[model samples]
Target: MLELHLNFCNLVEIPDAIGNLHFLEILNLMGNNFSTLPSLKELSKLQLLNLKDCRQLKYLPNLPSRTDLSSKRSLPESFSSKKDPWAFERFYDYMEAGLNTFGCPELIELERCTSTALSWTLQILLQVHYQYILPSLWNIPFPSIISSIIGGSEIPSWFNNHREGMGSIITIDESPLMHKGNNCIALACCVVFGPPASRRKAPPIIHSLNHVSVPFLCAEDRITEDHLWWFYVTSGSHIWSTKYENLKLQFHIIRESDIESWSFHGKKYGYRWVYEKDLEESNLTMICSR
Candidate 1:
């Protein structure tokens, strides 16, 4: 019964020696610097793996034959792919329509957004191992899911709209806002790898309000509130200015001055930044409500 708690140590890589802990039951390696995970095929008794902010990690290794992969349950839909036998082809088609030109933008914009989104997804799965497996393992393998989501297969309609809108306006090029004020654009994409929720609400709203100014973008009125939230704001962006109605929030902001260079981790790619603001606001409510 070997239990490991290696949280928040800023480790850059998983040691191959971890495979020796065959009796290991729990491993909490959250908040580390590890970009890739060590092989766990030898640890048949392993149970829980917590990798909350191992942001550097990009890919997961193949699991042992008996390992249950669905423990985390809420795998992002984007990770679902067609190449797999369980590939939700219909779902993929719908998502593609939602994000593609027939679905959202012109061909160029669709391609660009899809490419960037896929790149990010691959980067996340490169170094880790599937901690848990879903009861209903998709005929498709995990690697395929990573490829589909990142490559630009259709996602939920909300995501398509959000991606299209953002792709139309934002470019990878440095923005003026980054130079004048402390601001950067962070793009996040998650692919639920489990069963769909029975009663899911619309996707969260992505908002970017000029932090330096006032008048606050009300939650109900903000354009991003209804669809997949993809926000691009400067360092001056603020959430307090908006009206919130009981939502769990997590955010990370990176500015132009902060980034040093682009690098690769596993199949994923990452850009290093000098500064980043990461925050998680739980049970968020509007100030007016109070």
Candidate 2:
């Protein structure tokens, strides 16, 4: 078969026979219970593989490389090189056929960098869950979604709707249809970790809109360092969908006193608001980044 759609099927595993379908190109396995995937090294034509909402999935298998390592086809006399059989020129030649306006080199490189960053961030979250005892925070179900991380203690002042309390109401003038163009329908927050309290678990951060409560895992660590823990949720994910205009959104932290400073994680935008505490980590941040 050329296409397979098995989303929301409560699937625990996929058989290896899937790779045998050399002509298969699309595979959809979202909203399932699988934890891993089989190798698709033989599916040369495969593309558009979707695994969204596979919450239990923990890892992926080896993917086929861009070239066939075992192929014995003879090379042209002019192209033969004595150095490395698989040289940069060989790879470039292989890519020449598919290089187009939309799939240009720069766009491809950007996609690659984004993919790498997403993968690294997911790995960090997975390890955090298995190894730490910090208050459990829920993570986005899929790894392919665009996300980011930064360290800070205060909410950026740009969010004119924010307030000092654990929960506040904010309104937007746009409708749900207008938000379709945006990748994320939800927002995330960075909970500031204050002085450690022994044997006390911090409360989960909750976002309520239209009577739906979005519970996020509390961030662990002392605010002494410069780093903000981020968590995101999509609209209508665990809650009923609500329109964006005149939105009644509320932020709730069960133990507001424990949270020294907090801020919303702006999707696709960097923060211009700097808190006074950020200066202390200036040296360490520069050293690590360099």
Candidate 3:
């Protein structure tokens, strides 16, 4: 089993044998009855452990910290190209829609995010692995999920620039971050979106045509949350550079048939998705937290 949610079970203690579920990745013990958590060092594959509102919880073990691709699950064989939710066509539509979502994107997007994140992490993890080259022998693949969970509504600490409102141009100097950035190995984007929309308007975006995220989205609730995207981009030179290109993030461009001809960001292609009934068209703004 990969997940175990024992939230609000009113238990006083947990058995140490749980640590033996080596394949476990997520263990949520919120509102459980316990002051201390048992030693969880054996859960080598664990990725997330939620302990929210565990009022009695007073201590935790030296939890496993390895965050790599060891737990990456391949797409299942049950997947069908036409009948399934994560069909290729749905993915293409989402891509053509600029890859934006109502709030939290469907987990299928996780694959895209993971690929890009790997690029950004490769530059750093490669250096770490190099130090132990003899022991590692590079038998493992390096995947990263940098958890930027923070308190309140502030930009994540990793971003380089940020601003409010839409249609704003946050310019990037050709050789930006000359002294600070890590040679611009990759670009990560975060967008806060969504407002409650009725089923008529929300179904398309919420139950996104791609259907890959169907398992992730709760159809009954509103998707008012932040969405993040990462891209493995190459700097003009040296793979990644201190100086970067103009990273223009244009959000909420109400495009029409003629909008693409003059819009450089539109990439010379006509956008056809605008005709749909926009029941709750969101106001999108890009705060470049590079």
Point out the higher-scoring one by TM-score: 1 or 3: 3
Best by lDDT: 2
Q: Judge candidate 3 against the unseen true structure and give its global Cα lDDT, from 0 to 1.
A: 0.35
Question: Could you give candidate 2's per-residue lDDT for residues 187-286 as a string of tens digits?
Answer: 3333322323333342343444532211221332322332222333334343324544544444332212232233322222111111222222342233
In model 1, how large is the Cα lDDT of residue 121? 28
Q: Show the lowest summed lDDT stretch of 10 residues, model 2.
A: 95-104
Listed in order, each prediction's TM-score against the native is 0.28, 0.28, 0.38
What's the best-to-worst order under TM-score?
Answer: 3, 2, 1
lDDT of each: 0.31, 0.36, 0.35
Residue-wise C-alpha lDDT for candidate 3, range 53-110, written one tens digit per residue: 4555544444543322244433233435546644542222211111122232222333
Candidate 3 weakest lDDT stretch, 10 residues: 266-275
Compared with the true structure, model 3 gives a TM-score of: 0.38
lDDT of 1 by residue, 139-197 (tens): 32222222222222334332222223221112222333343324222322322111122
Where is model 2 more than 4 Å wrong at Cα? 67-266, 269-290
